[model samples]
Target: MPLTLPLAELEVGKHLYWQLGNLKIHGQVFLSSWVVIGALLALVVVGTRKLERDPRGTQNLLEFVWDYIRDLSREQIGEKAYRDWMPFIGTLFLFIFVSNWGGALVPWKLIHLPSGELGAPTADINTTIALALLVSLAYFYAGLSRKGLRYFEYYVEPTPIMLPFKIVEDFTKPLSLSFRLFGNILADELVVAVLAFLVPLIVPLPAMFLGLFTSAIQALIFATLAAYYIGEAVHEEHH
Candidate 1:
């Protein structure tokens, strides 16, 4: 018999579905997503349960993460409106970061799913597309809420020649964001699975670490761009 690696399968194209009155849902994705979200909630609850002035343990970690997110949102969204959107931006950052990390770190093989195996939520196109759409919505909302009907003027500012291009940009933006995230994460997971199959020991460690790093970077990029888009929408031009 030849060598066999069960994990090499990785279940890339397979999706587990949940039935709901003729509506089919990606059950695995939602299951994994809930796991990721639950973990974040648990962390927050545990971390803040015993808050101390001179923090230690989980509190310190939460404080560090909180401060990092605050700075990141403030830097991109600016001082004036950053606070208003910090929670949204921070949620995106944490959700993606944890989801990516969970997919890579968790040994889903050990946990039995109803159908297919679970992987990173980001690896799914639907998840990324949903996230990108949310960002796009945030951009429009930020502009409209702050500037009212005048927000449409952004397309024609500096010159009317830019109107068509700006309109096209709205469509392209979400496509770019979703595909970039989905491709990178899915590719990363597949590569690691292959490496683990070939070497099965020391070789996959480096790739795993790299995956974690890249996942974090992707999350940061998504959150930063989201903040920037919102910031640009709400920006005032001084003539």
Candidate 2:
């Protein structure tokens, strides 16, 4: 008997895996990812080419987004260090935001792949895990770079009783981030796929809209948490 994943074969990028050397790559995931990234780059180029004083069209939208990101980072990471990390946090938020909306709106599944279907990159567990690991690394870098050897003092702050829990938290943080994102995205795709497959018209519309809202929320939540983690690492209590 052949094994099968429940409700995954017909929806999103879960049909099969592409083997590339030692790595198990999903062709659809990368395909959509590159497409979305390319579009974003093109927008950046077009938006910056003119640079008018009033900031019209794409420039205005870009500036608005930039300011929002800046404010969010500042609120979470504090004034001193937020400027340095804003770009990273902004990129993470934008990528996830676009990817999620793309999955819900773009008919990527219409573009047939040799193995799997194209969905949001975040819908892939591997992509989410990679992103979560990057956040983990970013916080570690933030802590070590700002505090040097003193960063270790975080684990025992207040008292030594938090040492074990703090150590466990390091492992759990990445796991939580990855699974939460992957699960939410996959579930969104799943519901939309099932509705479209079954009703194929008006039934899926509501689900699709809900998916977009949830997608944005997920991106915001992920970015906020990431900035908070970095902020915590870099914050000094000043005793």
The prediction achieving the highest lDDT against the true structure is 1
Candidate 1 lDDT tens digits, 27-104: 989989999999999999999999999999999999999999999989998888898899999999999999999999
C-alpha RMSD of candidate 1: 2.6
Model 1 regions more than 4 Å off: 1-8
lDDT of 1 at 51: 95
**Which tens-of-lDDT digit does each residue in 1-239 have in candidate 2?**
48765555585545557788888767778888998898788988999999999899999999999999999999999998998899999999999999999888888877776667888989999889999999999999999999999999999998999999999999999999999999999999989888887788999999998999999999999999999999999999888
lDDT of 1 at 220: 94
Return the lDDT, model 2, position 54.
88
* lDDT comparing candidate 2 with the true structure: 0.90
